[model samples]
Target chain A: MISKSVAQFVRSLHQKKYRQQEGCFLVEGAKSVQEVLSSTFEVDLLLTTDAFYKENADGADRQRCRIETATAEELTRVGTLESNNAALAVVRMRANVPLLRAPDAWVLVLDDIRDPGNLGTILRIADWYGIDTILCSETTADVYNPKVISASKGSFTRVNWWYGDLTGVLNQANAPVYGAFLDGDDVHQSPFNAAGGYIVMGNEANGIGPNITPFVTQRITIPRYGDAESLNVGIATAVILDNLRRVQG
Target chain B: MISKSVAQFVRSLHQKKYRQQEGCFLVEGAKSVQEVLSSTFEVDLLLTTDAFYKENADGADRQRCRIETATAEELTRVGTLESNNAALAVVRMRANVPLLRAPDAWVLVLDDIRDPGNLGTILRIADWYGIDTILCSETTADVYNPKVISASKGSFTRVNWWYGDLTGVLNQANAPVYGAFLDGDDVHQSPFNAAGGYIVMGNEANGIGPNITPFVTQRITIPRYGDAESLNVGIATAVILDNLRRVQG
Candidate 1:
């Protein structure tokens, strides 16, 4: 049972400003809620349907988090995901930890990716490709946005994201830097090292920003077979990672 | 110069029912509106700002279509794209022409792509990869949806889409059938013919439907390097097409 004040607080967390002030963000839908329950993210509150509660009540973390049963209608009203009938969790935002670049694993650097959905999808792609760390420019979409959280499909729990000056971070990184371009060396034939490196994906409408350009040691292009002015950034990231994995494997 | 009746009609096209009833769909934003003007699609109406009118009024097709001046506010209110400030064109739905499966060109078969954005992104991927025709199951999202058009980023004009039974179309196609699966042959090492074939992409959550399963002669999988449970359907399509092009090129 949700009190009026608790309901208002949960609803407030939907907006980034409120989330920043409260130091927490929402994780909607069953998959993501379950993922956070098992991850290092500390859950402040869990509003869910009785069925979801029944299914997860035995988990060890249940003792540490506050749980409340919510009707489907209440969940829809409070959560950004209208179709979510399972749960929504208020997760405390951990301090921004510096991304640790593993010598043998690739790290994704995002340059001003604005769309929440694209950012979220990119996280999932990173998670799938075993790339653990993502460095986002300060202008990139907030990862805590409900849209991003929903789109990441629980992969957010596994991937570490740090937001700051991308140019500064990439410049200091230990590995080789590869940037995607329209007229660069074809990714299929490009020299890719099995020792992982940094792959920088640019903004949706704009390619890599001007500041980050000088840091790219190698320029790569995904050859286009037909006339699409460009590929969507999220799709491009996944395609690049897939190619990267092919070479590494 | 926008008429009350015209505004009501344009607003109604946002719904699939009205689009189907009117036998037309909207081409919103400057890029898509321009593409439709140059394409074979018959434009029934064009609502635009004065700047757009001055820019495009010289086109030969201008004589064949009705043109009206609309404020940015009006365009935002009537069109599905809220950010659109340039123009919107109401294009007649051309009859579903039989897919011209060029024997040496690949074709995409969508099993049950339900998201309009995913479907649109897939179309752009198809357009980029030179896959000219797409056979979609009746359950697939309508190609004429504004979200699909917006996401396609003008690729809608280059591609031909047909809605029908998946089983019937695959059984009738002259090319070999390839299905994407988790346990199928690794796409990296899979034998791909330079001659065009039908590549089947399944539903977002359900993968391929059972009814369409029997027609796939070859099963191919994109090997996972990370633990992401599955790639989004749109990402999967682009990745598969990229690999196919690698072999075909």
Candidate 2:
């Protein structure tokens, strides 16, 4: 049986304030926990059921962290996921080191993406399109938030993110900045001749902010054939990346 | 103020069984409630705050439904949304009449899409891409579920959906069937020459089921350039539709 204080500690990481105070965040579910154990991130503590421990003991044994056996009920009680039959891990947060855009490679820039789920989904999209680096505005949802971690499914391990002022990065950028806008040049027809650059996505309710808009070298739009007021920020990101890859090929 | 009995009745629609029993579902927030009031769908009851009523009194007046003035707190207390400051409406569920495929138009087919948010996001994607009709398996999340309605962001009013046996529909379908598979033809290079057909999407964990597999005339994939295992079903759907529209143009 797990102690009450330990459970309380794990549960505290669910909120951003506690996660910041502790400098660690919770990674719940079997897949995410396994990814974190295998990743470079330091695991502070791991709570796992007997079945999960048995199945992934090799990976768990390799990690330099405290491992405790717990029931599925205990995991569900202390975790943010609706049901977690496998494991939950307390992982040390990485320093927000600036992510440099590699030579001839694409990067994603997020501006004030407030929803945790949207932020996580964007991370997954970035992973899918092979965009390894992400730059986020300070107002964007905390990447360590449990909701963001849960929604990312294990993509959080693959994508590197830095939360800072977007203006400073955009202003210093040497590559072209393409921002998603409603009335900009059609993405399908836009000549993406540049080897690699930055693809900037904006807030859910608001498009790109004024501060970031001027730094945008080009404004791109996914032409709408129907009447949706707008596409979800995550969906728009995927479409933009897909089109960008298609043109580069 | 909404009566206790009426509040209880509206809350009952949150569940599928009661929604089925009463032949009604709830649409929350100002935008969705307004969309329901203006749509062809019948509205049974509408609960609105004074601000929303004042701003949208004309739209509310146009509906042939019971309109009761309630405080924002009462609306939030009675509704599923976390903070509903505007309105909520009890809307009659549409009859599950099979949606006829329009000539030279693509239709979406969903197989066991269990998540309401994914289903709703797909609906919005369809609305954005101009794919108006969707055919879903019976196991798919209820289209009238509040989560689906909220995630759809009023796209439910514009798009049409029918849920039933997938095999029966696919077996009788004359149009080409394209199923999203991990190892299918690269969507970037695939020749989407068909005038109009079906784009089939599967469950979160499972691809298209065995029953629906045989009907797929063309197997397509969104080529992954990175190490992420798979795309979310909704994201995949948007990517496919965007490519389809690009090629068709």
Candidate 3:
């Protein structure tokens, strides 16, 4: 049985304030915990059921953490996921890394993406399209939020995320910036530069912010055939990336 | 001010059983309620704040429905959305219309898409791409669910949804059946028939079920460039539709 204080401590990480204060965040469920174990982050706490421990405890990284045995019910009580049956881990947050210049690789730049689920889905789409890094405006949703982590599935492990000034990064990096806009060049017909660059997705309700617009070298749009107002930012990301890759390939 | 009994009755529609029994469902927030007013579905009740009623009551469709003045606090208490400052409508559910054969236009076929949000997003994507009809397995989430309605935004008004046997519809469809599979031909390379047909999307965890596999005349895939396991079903749908539109256009 887990102690009440420990359970309380684990639950506290659910809030952004507590997570920032502690410099650690919760990763729950079997898939996420496994991804955390395999990732570069240091595990501060690893609470798992006997079955999960028996199956995955053999890894060397498991020995580096403060591991504890707990029941599935105990995990569900402490975890953000309602139906977590296996494990929950508190992984240490990495320091904010500066954006790197990689002109040959497509990077996703997000501006004020408010929804955690949308941010997470974009991360997963970035991972799927081999876009290794994501640069987010300071106003964007916190990447370490449990909902964002949960929505990303295991793709969070592979995608590098950084929240900083989008304009600063776009200006510093020697790459063309392509923004998703309402009345822009048709994505299907727009000729993408063979050398990769940046694709900036904007806020859900608002398109690209004015601060970031001047840095954009090209404004591209996903052609719409019907009357729906706009595509969800996450869906738009995937659709745009698919087109980007098709053009590059 | 709304009556207490009426508020309680409206709240009960949150559950599927109550909605089915009453043949009605809730549409919350301003955009959705506006769509419900304009649609063919009869509105049983329209609960609106004074501001919304003052601004939009001039519309001709408002005369056709029972319009009630309600406060924002009363709406927040009775509705599913936390910040519903505008309106909520109790809409009568339409009878399930059988799937129509749309050989010349795209019809999205869903197999056990369980999440209301995914189903809703798919409906929005369908509306965006001008795919008028969505055919779903009976196992799919209810189209009238409040979460689905909210996620679809106003696109639910434009899209026709029917839940029935997938095999029967595919067999009867006079056009080619295209199924999204990981092992299928690359969608970018695969030539889409200019005459539109059916595009079958699968469930969250599983791909297209075995029973539905035999009917797929063409197997297509979105090429992945990175290590992410899979795309969310909704994102996958929009990407596929974008490609299909690109090919057809």
Candidate 4:
């Protein structure tokens, strides 16, 4: 049975203030929860449907994962998303923004990416393409945001995210920093071409924020022949990564 | 000033039945509304914040857009999406999904692709890369879904979309049909493949649906060294397009 105080506490996580106060954020769905439990992330609590707990609890024996069987309705009530998931967990946040070990390599830097789904999707892309580290600016959505966590599928477990000033970081970087722009040299051909550099993607509605623009060695654009005003950030990154990597790959 | 009945009518388009009955769908925001006004797609109605209409009405004259000015409150009452915009347009549905006119070259087929944003983003990718036609299986979400329209960023203006039995379509194609599957041959090693073929992408959660499997000549898989379970459909498509296209300016 979920106590009223527990219910209130779980509901409070929707706001950033409450999440910081608790030092935790919510994760939902069986797949994501299982992925987190298997990783280095510390699962403080795992509330799941009794059927779900019975189905997959043994092999995923994480002593830190304290499983509490609950009804679907109860899980739904605490869920931060529109969909009711089979499992839910409150995991401690990874507060450290570790220095990217190999900074010269292809590191994706997100500037003010506010949408959790977009942020999460971006992480999954990074994982798929074998990008080891991602640096997100301060205004980018929190990595622990529920929507971001869900959209990331399970990629967040392996992907490290941090809140830092992208402008400052890129300015001091040893290699090229490519910022996507509306009118830049074709990404297919640019001199900032090194084995690895920072590929900076900006916010959804806005291009590269002013703070980071000056630091970019080349403002690159995906060759667009059609009438689209701009590609979705996730799509644009994929296009750039595919093109840039093909030349080097 | 928007009337009560009109607001209700506009808001009703959120429901599939209402959209079907009216033979129209909603497109909102400055970019979306502007795209519909500029495109050949017939605009049944237009509602915008007076401030926007006054500033941007000149362009509407070129497209012969029928403009209706509404208060923020009225737009709020009528808008289907969470974020209200400066403008909204009711575009008459493109009821016909025509067979591929240029099926001789590379084509895209979506087998139950569900996400609106993914579908829209895919359409935009198709437009940018010069994939003239995309065939959608019956289960795929409607291309006109407002979320899809908004996410496309106006790429829907060019790409031709059709819904039908994907198997039948594949059977008719003269070239080898390719399907992207986890079990398929590594896409990287696959040599100068067939020129004209239907490239099938599957649903969001599930890979390719069963019906379309038997008809494919080749299965392609993206090599992944990271922990991500799957790539976003839009990303996967862009990656494939980059690989297949004759890469030169």
Top-scoring candidate (lDDT): 2
Off by over 4 Å in 2: none
Worst 10 residues of 4 chain B by lDDT: B186-195
Q: Residues B97-170, candidate 3, lDDT per residue (tens digit)?
A: 89686557878999999999999999999999988889889999999899999999889889888888889888
Better of 1 and 4 by DockQ: 1
In the predicted model 1, the residue pairs found to clash are: A128-B226, A130-B226
Could you tell me which 10 consecutive residues in candidate 2 chain B have the lowest summed lDDT? Answer: B186-195
Please state the CAPRI-style docking class of candidate 1: high
Candidate number with the higher DockQ (2 or 4):
2
- For all candidates listed, what's the TM-score of chain B alone? 0.96, 0.98, 0.96, 0.91
- Fraction of true contacts retained by every candidate, in order, equals 0.85, 0.79, 0.88, 0.67
**Tens-digit lDDT string for candidate 1 (B22-140):** 99999999888888888888889889899987888765245488888888889988888868889999999978766767868888999999999999999999999988889999999
lDDT of candidate 2 at residue A198, scale 0 to 100: 91
Of the pair 3 and 4, which is ahead by TM-score? 3
Worst 10-residue lDDT window for candidate 3 chain B reads B54-63
Q: What is the C-alpha RMSD of each candidate to the true structure, in Å?
A: 1.4, 1.2, 1.4, 2.4
Per-residue lDDT over A14-130 for candidate 3, one digit per residue giving the tens place of the 0 to 100 score? 999999999999888888788878887788988988899888886424548878889999999888887888988888998889868475888889999999999889888988998
Provide interface RMSD per model, one decimal: 0.6, 0.9, 0.7, 2.2
Model 4 superposed RMSD (Cα): 2.4
Ranking by lDDT: 2, 1, 3, 4
Error of 1 at A159 (Å): 0.6
Over B130-249, each residue of candidate 2 has an lDDT whose tens digit, in order, gives 989999999999999999999999999999999999898889888899999877888888547567888899989988998899999999999888878889999999999999888785
